[model samples]
Structure formats: structure tokens, C-alpha cells
Target: MALRGTNQEFGRPYNRRIVLESIRLHGPIARGDIARRVGLTVQTVSTIVRELEEHGYVLSVREEPRGRGLPPATLRINPEGGYAVGIHITPLGIDAALTNLSGDVIESAHREAPNATPDLAFDLIGAMVNDLTGLRPGGRVLGIGMALPGPFGVESMSFVGPTTMTGWKDVSLRERLAASTGLPAFFETDMAAAAMGERLYGLGTGYSEYYYLYFGVGLGGVMVHDGSALRGAWGNAGEIGHIPVVPGGEACPCGNRGCLERYLSLEARGRWSGSDADWVAEIGPVFRNAIAVVENLFDPETVILGGLASTDLLERLAGSATQLPNSVSARRDRASPRIIVGRGGQYAVLRGAAALAVSGVLSPRFGQMFTAERERGRDLLQGKGMAA
Candidate 1:
């Protein structure tokens, strides 16, 4: 299978991204070291470095020579090189942030938007965008990345459903947000956005594949493979909220009985008054089964627990979880545990939303990686005088 990647182009752009990635991942590094690491000739690396410097994606700082020669120059990502606006529109409200090229949060704002009309929602987001971008003197906001509860635009789905945000049934979020904010918009399911957030800013940077279990007021997940979210048909791949964990438990808007979210989510728990012990016992089986299902289906290297729900609730769940059923991730010699607990909670999703924007501008996507490969193949053929 073609390795899933993104946002890279053939030739100079591809090389440029590599150089930037090196600086981003291990910054304040010298050009010669970068050339050695990325496997490029010194001259080629120098040319790309010069371009990066001219465009402001990198800043050069002088490094002391190890022993004798003149001090070397080091390159690091320029915090002001680029900017992106990340908006997380949840059932409760809109959370937004301005992130620099390095995925650092420069500024942030939040506005509650329960059942907010389209005009009101866009107005709030627009004002925040203006305020955020205003912080960066002359720096342009490249685009806006948004994450909201999903099954986006699905016909016959009721907006009044508990899992869905009200007043969003008739609105086209992408179009409205772009038009209102006057910037291009990218959209994702909240869980998907959380996964992207982790990938760019949290646990995801180290592992290429993992499952993100987001504990929004309800439960959901995002399957990330090789750093890109696995978008199922209709971009609703990780709608695990409706996964049937309770069989005959609770009536769900998705027309299922006993969805796992009913048992595991804070909203559902808030509806009852059982003791924590009794409650934990009731919820334990479902989470156990759900974790097993994730292992079997995704075979992720790690599973991260995140989202904007009760930390005590999630911590209890994570603490009580048992050894996973035999799956790809379960192994004896693994350096890190199969499961990772995320403490960022609500902020993680918001930061991840920002990461989506950062990713679009910074990450090397599969399309470009493939395009670069194709060009190389063409060059090989042309060198042999095989094809015009």
C-alpha cells in the first residue's frame, strides 16, 4: 500500500519540507548535520536552506565551533514564519486558537455556542479570528481548520440528536466559516481533529499509528495510520460514540441500543446517581470490550485517551482497564505501553484543532510523496531514453 502522507510536493518543495521538518523536529541544528540526516548533498541542502531562510520559515543562529573552525550556523523554525487559525466548534461552544509555524499557541479565545444560529456562530468565530491574527504583525493566517461533532451533512440525520449540535442542520460550516472569516477552511470530526492534534503536538509525533479515544461529553475515536486520519466513506470513520456497548442498555439517536457512550461518557453518568464503585463496575465491561475492538480493528501501536470530559472519570476508566486481548499492539518487548493516558483533556482537542492548520502548512503529505516518487521514476525512464 502507498504510505499515507501529506502536504509535500515533488522536487524543491519536497526537499524544502524535509529540511523544515528536520529543523522543526530537532531545531537549532546546523546545515551540515541536516544534510547528513536527510541524506542530501551539501550543496543541495545549502540551496534549500537559503530558500527557507529567505522565506522566513527558518531563523539562523550562530553555533560555537566544536574545536577549531569558525562558528557554525544553526537553523530553527521561525515562530512567525506562518500562522493558522484552529476552530473547534463543539455542541457547547466554539474554541479557537492561533498557532505559529512551530505549532505553538500564540493566542486563544472561546465562546459558548449552544444552539447558536449560523450568523451568531460565524460572527463569534470571525471576531476571534480577527483578534488572533491581529496579534501577528503583518503575518498572514494561512487557513482555518475546524472540528465539530460530525456525520457532517448526512441526509436524514436529525440535528436534534443528543450527539449532534443544535442549529447546525441547515448550515454549511465550511462555506459559512470561510465566507465569514475570509479564509480557506478545512473540516474534521472532533475525534479526528483530536487525533490530528495529538499527531502534531502530542503523543502522535512518536508513533506512526495509534488509536485516539476522545472522551468528549460523549465517547468517540480517531484511527490514525502513518500520521493521517483514516477517513472512512463520508469522513465519519471514528464515530465510535454509537458503538453498541450496552446491547439492550439505552436508546440512541443513531438507532442503536446501549451505545458505549451511554455507559462511559460523563454526560450519561451525570444523568444517574449511583455510587462510583457501582458505576465503575457497570462501565468497566464496555470499556474493556471497546478497547479490545479497537485493538483488533486498528492494530495501533498505542491508544491515547483524550477529550473535554471529566478527568476523574477518564482516569478511573484508564486505571481500571485490563490487559488488552491479543492484538498487534500487545507485545513483550515494547518500549512504551500499549495504552497512553492523555492529561490535556479539553485543551488537547483545541490544540489538536490548531495542529490541523499547522499540519496543512508543515507536514509532508502522501500525495506529494507519491508525486515525488513518480517524478523520480520518470527521470529514470528518461535517462534510459525510454519515454518522452
Candidate 2:
């Protein structure tokens, strides 16, 4: 129906944000309709629309006949007026993408991860951004959103396991990256970024709640509820890769035996190097078990298979996961299958990273703004947002 938590009492900034979001989501729609739907007064919507149009954020594309009155103008987001960058750091490599306000990829680049020491990686990132920006000068850039593999911000470097970026302990990513690139940067777990990407442009277009199983050099996952990630209290919500699947089977760097990824991840298969038939055999039971837990735990619309893993391989994994336990999502007339293989493929996390950048420009994050205000609004306060 109407948008969430919107009330007559909310101020101009809030109303303007809702107007902007409405135009982005449901435009070339009339301002009159936006006013009716978001419960804002016609004068308020008209003023917000005028402000947005003057700022190059919204454009009056066309007009619709209104029977006995002047035709109403239809407005939509101006794709070229703003741009965003998404960067995904993986054990295998780093991927970066530049996208317009509409989330369309304008350009992309990739570099091998082994070359990415703290200094080198920063330089590479700066160079990549320069290349993308230079392609078409004069486009306004929103900022960069970075997706990194975690257990992030831990003090003592782990002797072994997934938290293995060398020379990175105590090197604050947001602080360092911002200083190096001279752009506001936001960081998130790769899987969570992928989930947000899907939320904006992929499977999340249809499903509100789903599980993203990201198969990379390592395995990770994120559960999406509503349109945002379910970031736990400390922001370390999704780490399903370390879940013990083959109990007492293999030693894991996360200090567990038989972690699910140990048996079913692509890296594990690569290290072992078996035939596809042998590979299928090795991954089946663990995948089935992981599905059982994932399906039962969240009762999401489906389990999305995504990340750096190839679609052919993900299909095999999805095929092998046939024995899903009974759940609320398994009802008759179910629109979604138990498993959905992602189409974004390798760029899923990168696209997700881009989505975060777009969100910073379009969505209202009062919670984040207030928290940054406590810090005197340094890098986090990209005042460029809320306006666009």
C-alpha cells in the first residue's frame, strides 16, 4: 500500500526522500500519484518534485492526459545525473564496477588478488576508478561501496583460516580507503553486498526473503529479510561457511571440524581435483544438509546459489539438493523453487557493492546519519545523499 512508517508529521527531508524513492521505484509516474500514495500533501509533493527536477535527480519524461484538466507530468530518475562504484575483494581477485543511477554497469575491471598488498591494492583501486571516471567526464559520482570477505576488524591476525589479508590488521579500511581514493567509501561483507545487489537488480526483484549461498575461493552466505540484510548486533550476521557439516571430519581454520564449505566449496574441490562425477558425489550430502538447515531456519522464498562459482557448478549443487525438509515455503502453488541459481554469476557481489553506492544516493538512512553525527559526521556523512 503506502510506504513504510510515513506519517504527516515527518519533516521535509523525510518527505523529500520518500518522493525521490517513489520516483525511482515507480516512475515515469505522476507527482499527484506519488502524493496520494506516500500520503504527502499535493503542495509538498509538487515542491519536492520541483526541487528534484532542478537538481537533475528527476526528469519530467512525458505527460499523461487527466480527462478534464491539464495533463499531469510523468517523472523518472535521471540515470546520467549520478554514478556509483562497487568493489568486491575476494581471495581469487578483486572486481570493480561503475554504474549509473539506474544500476546499469557502465564499465568494470578486475585484478588478481595476489597482486593486492595494502599499498598495491589501494593504488590499483585508485587507478581503476580513474579509468572508469575518465571514460565520460562530468558525470557526478555518488561514492564507492566495497565488499570484503570477513571476520573483519579483528585485532590479532589469525594464524590460519579465512581472515587472511596480510598487512591489514589494524589498517582501518574505511579510513584508509577514503584517504587514498579521496571518495567516501562504505564496507560490507561480500555476501551481504551480493544480497543487496540482488535486492536492487536480480532475484531480489521478486523475492523479499531468500538465502544467498556465495561460493568463492571460500564459501559464505547472507540471509535477506525485507529489502535489507539481517546484520546481527555486531554486524557479523552471516558466516554459514564455518557451520560444521561433516562433523568430526576435517580441521577448519575457523577452529571447527568438518565445516560445510570444507566438504562442498569450490576451493575444496580444486584442492582435491577430482572428476566431475567424483565432485558431485563429494558435495551431495553436505549440500542437502545445508539446504535442510537453511530452509528450516529462515523459511525463505528460496535458497539463491551465487558468487564466483560458475552457474554450471551451482546448477549441479542445486540439483544435488533434492531432499529439502518440509517447511512453510514448500506449500502447494509455491511460486519459487527451493533453489534459485543466480544469473549475476561472478559479478553478483560487485553489482551488490554497486547497489550500496546507489542506496547511499537514493535511500534515507537516518540511523546511519545520526550515528555518524555522533562522530561529527566525517567520512560517513556524504551530504551528497538525501539531496539526490
Which residue pairs show collisions in model 1? 5-365, 5-366, 6-364, 6-365, 6-366, 7-365, 197-352
User: Per-residue lDDT of 1-388 in model 2, one digit per residue for the tens?
Assistant: 3563255343555566678878888888997888888888788789878877776888996556657776767899999868888888765667889988888899999888762667777788888888887776987787788887766654432213543454555667877767766766787888788877777778777888888887776677788887678888867677787788775888877677888777777778787777766797777877777787887888888889987777888888888767666666677987878898987777778878877766764565544643453356332212444341
lDDT of 1 by residue, 1-388 (tens): 3212123334555566667777877788998888888777778888777777776778999866788887988889888877888888766778888988777788889897776677888899999899999998788566788888777666644355665676578777778988988875677778888787777777788888889998876678988887788988778778787777665888877677887887777667777699666777777777777888898888778788888766776677777776556776677778777677765556666667766656555554524433554667642112222232
Pairing residues by index, what is the TM-score of model 2?
0.87
lDDT of each: 0.74, 0.74
The CA lDDT at 95 in model 2 is: 81
Q: Lowest-scoring 10 consecutive residues by lDDT in candidate 1?
A: 379-388
lDDT of 1 at 384: 26
Misplaced by over 4 Å in model 1 are 1-45, 70-74, 156-160, 274-278, 322-330, 362-388
Measured by TM-score, the strongest candidate is: 2
Q: What is the lDDT of candidate 1?
A: 0.74
Off by over 4 Å in 2: 1-15, 36-39, 63-71, 153-167, 325-329, 366-388
